[model samples]
Target chain A: MTLKIKKTDYIVITAILVWGLVGFWFNVQGAGAAEHKYATIYVQNEQVAELSLSEADSYEYSFDFGPENEHTALVEVEEGRIRMLPLEDDICPRHICSHTGWIEYTYEKIVCLPNQIMVVFNESSRGTTREDLDGVTY
Target chain B: MQPTTLKMRNRLNYLTYLAVLITFAVVIHTVEAALPLPMPVPGVRLGLANVITILALVLFGLRSGLLIAVVRSILGSLFIGGLFGFGFWLSITAGVTSCLVMGLVLVFQKRGLVSLVSVSVIGAAAHNLTQLGMASLIIANPDLLRGYYPLLLLLSIPTGLFTGITAHYLEDVTRRMIIKSGPGAGQ
Candidate 1:
């Protein structure tokens, strides 16, 4: 016997799939929503603003570009701060670094692919259980 | 002589078609590597060979389509295995699962036409999820899969549609010209 899948049945299935996708997308974003735990220590040329994590999972730290954007340092979580330059392109026009914003505590990504500047915020990815790299002199 | 002549020609033609399908799979695997997107994932490859697998199902049969998926995965990896790292296991599992899902539809369900568009769309859509599930098993990060699941589904929509359409067009032309024309046209 020929299986007759009605138009309505297929539509319902498609709708269910789309709804499932929408639900999953929101979950990832919400779960990924770090609490305001990441504090940015902005270092522009000679200027510096020390931002620290007052608590875990906190997110969003900001810095001023001073209308003369140059360079900055980023310390993800407990790792030592590393200086990074922003990627310049017509696409990434926002300049995530210069704008008043906050990012995660660790695995902090500074992707300037075209300019070859990629300072990632690899906070927890760095073996947290292992001794700090700074302390290991070997 | 008539029956034997037809049988030998048929076998050779089948082998030739399988060879051509493998070539297509290899080309797609290479493209997946060369065209690297800036997406956050460590390894993100399109299941383009799935087009061939779906085509095999629609044109030949479920078993043949399953064969295409298996052969392509093994041969494609042999050529471009470097980029995948440990993720090969994940892709293979998901690839097989998705193919089986569609192949089952073809084998068991008579009415649902195994169009290249439908089969690969279903196959490619599930490919990433199945692979991600495999990765989660290795990384011990089930929650990570849960987190990325939603975004992956969103991305699959347009990509799946495009790939499905391409597969559909290519298969229709090739089936019309090649498979449909071969000696076994009546049988």
Candidate 2:
């Protein structure tokens, strides 16, 4: 029997190829972070603080969801990048966020589900006119 | 042969076929789950279980294919203690969506609009999209789709093609065996 290629086959193949290409492009764009200069922290989807990555600094933030549901993360800014340092004190089950080191890309995020906290990098601090803000501001 | 006895035998055959297909699917699912992947992507898998689903759809009909998909997913989740969690919901939704898409393609196949491989690819894509939609809703992050869904779609193609080829061969062999056994063997 001869194997026949139908119109639907071509459509399916083209769709998959296009999807893969688009996904790959986004991933590449997200990983390019040389131009990013700020890291913003959010607690429960609310913006808590924004820190500049133009200089080196370190700080700690805590989220208290309830009496026994508090969580803390050590945020460090160095080498034009921001990262959450993995600490033994973290009570989260999987320390994946802490293990994700040095996120410099604008789209990169460090999320702590248990504490409902997210740290994301941005090109500039939100609602700010200047790109050179050096200190953390709420 | 008596008509009533033949009818009863045919019913028995169908029930037996369904049970066997479900068992095969569950076994394949569990085994594939145990295999290690290069990455820890949540929805990524070889999808060997779809082999049975496609076989049932091609050899029997839409209802049998849907029944096998539903039963296999539910039973697999129950066996793995994922009956009431995010994983269970994703699996059931993906399974049902893929089966329905494949069934639709099969309807079109009657008019030679698509081949088995195309049907499998569409089903696989549908499965990934359904899972991505469910995951986005659960996490309340539409960004998840933007970030990860494309990779899942790209992976589905090769996996779908492999399962489709396997199902095609298995269906042919089983069909021939049934015909050779007796006129009533496949009834």
Candidate 3:
């Protein structure tokens, strides 16, 4: 097989590699950094209830937050919205998107198993913007 | 061989193949579109129609497989009103790569089934990468992406295994049917 990769293909592969490098670099940078004033929306699985930042890590990552036991909702802050992203889809009957229903928070989430999705609000850093995370190309 | 013998050779039935591929694609798209998972990502999918891509790669060749993929994506988009905008490109890229690679493998190893499995796995991983890259660029959240790596790797392993096995079983049965029904089989 030729070692040469087309420009588009190269872009895809390199982009993935770069994504990892940048993420790694930032995680190291972000470790032990001060926590900001962002809210931590509570989600046990697919159901999302509001929680203080102090209670954020109280539940496990796989906790189900919704009435339906199908998929779990994981919270992540993105662009000032509590995006209720579904982490996995229920293999159960009537494949419902755990995200279905009302969401007041800008970044809300509803996760489904097998299809892991995490939606949360964009955590606003006190004195820093999303750009504070160095190596962040965007 | 005489010129008359050459002239009598039956040409491949391309129209029928195209029709079948398109219809199957439409049905798969309907299933994908009408149904939503418990969780929603703008572009993530099970890629169920890819099973057909594997089948085509093994039985026909790269060209037919590519044609089927393109037709499927285009028609699938029309039906769903193109909910997956960037996802369209990602799937097309993954489909093309998988079909071509699998076709080359079959040419060298004569293992169409195995090739299908590998190709599907590759497609799943590539599809994930495509979305991840876009997220990094557009969403401006590095931590959000870093958080996804473990899940992607974990999801890929089993999904790849299952999809490959399914494609393998389907290809084996379909191949037998094709052989038994083809013009020279009984004779």
lDDT per model, in order?
0.57, 0.76, 0.53
Docking model 3 quality class: incorrect
The residue ranges of model 1 lying beyond 4 angstroms of the native Cα positions read A1-13, A16-20, A25-138, B1-3, B38-44, B83-85, B107-116, B179-181, B184-187
Interface DockQ of candidate 2: 0.30
* Candidate 2 lDDT over residue span A1-138, tens digit each: 334668888887788879788887977676554343677788778887888765445454443443464444567777557777664444667877787877765556899776667888654432222345454222
Provide i-RMS per model in Å. 7.5, 4.7, 10.4
Second chain only: TM-score per model?
Answer: 0.82, 0.91, 0.72
Q: DockQ of every model listed? A: 0.10, 0.30, 0.03
Q: Whose DockQ is greatest here?
A: 2
Lowest lDDT 10-mer window, candidate 1 chain B?
B108-117
lDDT of 2 by residue, B7-47 (tens): 78667667777888899999888777677889767668878
Superposed model 3: Cα runs more than 4 Å off: A1-138, B1-10, B39-42, B101-116, B134-150, B184-187
Candidate 2 Cα outliers beyond 4 Å, as residue runs: A1-7, A26-138, B1-3, B182-187
TM-score of chain A of each: 0.27, 0.52, 0.25
Least accurate 10 contiguous residues by lDDT in model 3 chain B: B2-11
TM-score of each: 0.58, 0.65, 0.50
Q: Candidate 2 versus the native: TM-score?
A: 0.65
